[model samples]
Target: MHGSRSGRHRSDPGVAAAAGDSGLKPKGPSTLQALTDLVRLVGRSNAPQLRLRLVGAVLLTLAGKALGVLAPLVLGAAVNSLASGQGTAAAVGWGFGGFAVGWALVRLLSSTAPQLADVVFAPVRSAAQRRAATETFAHALSLSLDFHQTKRSGSLSRTMERGARSVDFLLRILAFNLVPTGVELVLAAGVLGARYDWRFGAVAVVVVAVYTASTFALSNWRLEHRRTMNTADTEAAGVSVDALLNYETVKSFGAEARSAAVYDRALGDYTRAALKANSSLALLNMIQAGIMNLGLGVMAVMAGFEAAAGRMGPGDVMAAVLIMISLYAPLNILGFAYREVRQSFIDMEEMLKVTRQTPQVADAPGAVALAKDTARRGGSIAFEDVGFRHDARANGLEGVSFNAAPGTTTALVGPSGAGKSTIVKLALRLLDPQGGRVLIDGHDVRDVTQASLRTAVALVPQDVALFNDTIRANIGFARPDADEAAIWAAAEAAELTAFIRDLPEGLDTRVGERGLKLSGGERQRVGIARALLADPCILILDEATSALDSRTEAAIQKTLRKVRAGRTTLVVAHRLSTIADADQILVLKAGRIVERGAHHELVAHVGGEYAALWRKQTRGARART
Candidate 1:
């Protein structure tokens, strides 16, 4: 059943207090806020091993940068010594060989350090991604039906996947690329100033600053394009999933062409958006490369002048250029990192928006488990002047009140939009009434834990949905610990024993998505089996046997009587013949019960709603025969 909202103000007394502003759309987090949140999350992780790996990664990154900066100087010294040519053959060989070996060792370690760091940090990054996805998924499941009804499952899943991937990307690129690059830049500048000339240091700082600033500005400008692309991607994914899930409907109407056209249009939008984003990224990369090469040119010119004037050797000039080249390597990836980091922040923000949404229906503080009436064989249900109004419906349950005593059956029959389903939802506390309370076993449902209420009620919806798993798994899902005998007994009672016995795999036969592999009647029987396995005090059969043929329906009807013997059964029926023998029948119109009596008594009324419906159904059946 759909969710309902209060037709009155917040100050209104009664069950209107249970309604909340679930429709309030929340804003996504900003980049700075996302960064802060990630920092806090890492701190809160509090894993000693994670902290140790993090620390090792940082220390190793620094060591790699330092060694990289020093390697050029060592190589330059070796070049200068060999060039001097002022010693014996063996002396020169020893001097140059020692310097060459030292340089090779430093350079070898420099390249190896970052790899080791990545290896050590792998666990931490994976753990973060797992925690993010798991927690967000769990939270999404906890959200009320109102939020879920309005949400696109595929889009939500895409958001979660992108968010988790973005976290991994940010950790890898920021830690290994951006942050380490900054440290490398500072160390390179310091080495330049302290070794050859301060002019080299000054030029390095200016060029790096310009490159960083320009990359940041351009990446920010490209953010809108990326956002558009992401939106289109999500929309495309959602369309494909919806089309596939409703494959039967599409096939029924021969609408495959329409679905394909819709998907093509979505892809077209995504392609255009992606083109813009990628083109801008290409431009950013070109600009970054230009700045680095120009900086290198300036350093080379300064070094050439210094060497010409005898203030620096050929080796020193070579060392200076090599140092600048080493610095540019990390900056080379800087453009890519900036673009990805910006995109990642957007993804993270979207995930945060979903995680932050408040559930419209939440458990009350200090709520306890439902205390069933032990003396009775079945639990009783009562609605006291209950009222509800859906936003899209003009008529909903209004000042409606009814009761089904223990061990009795109450049937609700009504025209479309007459609130039969709404009544069922209210009984199960899926949606709290706006004006009154619902009691189960003489205890207010709202006052008890939702889990406990769920334990006492079982529902078999009109369209039964099952997971893509074995038949045994779907039935056992209702009660995981239910043993084999109990499951077989329930299936046998539901008239599924013959069907399963004939199947090649029996209970192990796998049902396709939403149990579409089975026929309507078969799925309905599966639903009945699952509900019977639950063995709740309150059994809700909403058109439970609507899909079966007459013979099968008759058989199930007899089985249902046995199942409902000691249970308070609530039947929402459309076929008048189905509920003709119900203990008490309520005929509803426009959300109000217009007649209440046994089926015989209601049919005896001349020109009444129940009498009219029964005559029409009976005539339709006769005509079919």
Candidate 2:
């Protein structure tokens, strides 16, 4: 079946192939018509395989309904035969025998249909779920880094999971629940009209119509409640993730109680919303049960009268009553199925919104590929009148421009909130400069492919994040195709091979979530090893050894000299001694460069901020000793 225009398909047939021969536009339908349109809309795909499965299901359902109607008629015939006294024993015996067989057949089919439906629908449901998840994740990853910075990872993950599950729910409703219910309704109406009179059919139709209307109305009203519950649940999840990630900090401050209180507030809101939703659902169920049985009572009374007046035979009356009760089985699921479908629609809308979001940092059309270049032969990095500001921030960097020649280490030291990281982020194209440009090897960063640009640069972040996997796997992530020898060499250069070799599993040991099993110094070494494996032309150490012990820091400092020998390196650090041997140091304050000189030269300047920072660090180091 084809989806609606709102859910556009890849292929469109000619206008002549549409429902209208004149090819005129089709107007929107009324609510009842719209419901029919929804079924047609869902059926528009017209997949031959799906059609065949649905056809088979419909045939099975009709057979089941026919048997169901037959059982009651047979039982009523036995009663009539006993009343007539024409070989009553023999007549009753045959009638009951036939009824037993027919009843058994109906019961057997009723149980088998769901199993058959699942077998047929599983592939379609899985395919739709896969499509939805793949698209949602791809779209999220494609968005600019700035967009990601503002969103929570846990929340995004939850949205993607919910969206994917929604597709499965929708497919099951459409393929199994809703479709079978529709078929049952049609069959019941036809049998009632033929066996008894149009009045019986009218009563059946009215009850179903009222049941459907009430279901829709109640579901629509509950939508806001569900949405509120979702919001509260998301907030609760986000709070827990945030707290757990910062557990150490919370513990350090002895604020566990405060954190728990915050979480409780979110959970409390969630509980209230959940209660409201469930309560509303219960009320709907209660009302539906009352109305449906009342309608059944009315139909049963009419059927008795018809039999007494001889307008319909006793068997016909019994068949009409039996069909009505049998049809209620599917109708019972109809209410909950409708609710799920509406919920699925809401989820689909959210997923589509995310999927349709255009990436802000998309590559220009006809963009050229970036060519690989090693540090041994790579050239200088430069920025020209670059300016940037976060969408949420009023100011970031303004007209900042600088250059670091190849075979030199440029250290950027700054006060807190000085936009030093912003410069790095912009140069790496993680955040595009609103004005001017950043160039690497004389090529504009935006002019070349991101893959090529990233391949040319490597970053070792201050807070090194490692995967929960083998030590070798984490280190070799930068170069997945690297051999064991290459991995060992990189680890040795980072001064970590000896420690890894001593572990129980050597390099194959599991890291435990975010490398929590490893010490701070060890995690830092792993980060360095990853960067060494990458061997990018431009290397960035953003306080790479900050978490290490002083002894380990001193050791890694020696490793850094060898690593930066031929590479263009940018070091952002607060510890002045770490960058004392750098080719140049840029001191920044309030988003602008305050001073630029060698460390020794900057130290010699009496009134410079770098000189004061140096004295303060020297005093602190002496106190620690």
Residue-level lDDT for 477 in candidate 1: 87
Model 2 Cα lDDT, one tens digit per residue, 511-535: 8888888888899999999999998
Candidate 1's error at 617, in angstroms? 1.4
Top of the candidates by lDDT:
1
Error of 1 at 482 (Å): 1.9
> Can you give the lDDT of residue 112 in candidate 1?
96
Summed over model 2, clashes come to 7
RMSD (CA, angstroms), candidate 1: 8.5
- After TM-score superposition, the amount by which residue 583's alpha carbon in candidate 1 deviates from its true location, in angstroms, is 2.3
Cα lDDT, all candidates: 0.83, 0.74
In the range 465-571, model 1's lDDT, one tens digit per residue, is 99999999999889999999999998998999999999999999999999999999999999999999998889999999999999999999999999998899999
* CA RMSD per model (angstroms): 8.5, 8.8
Error of 1 at 41 (Å): 3.1
Task: Provide the lDDT at 283 for model 1.
Answer: 83
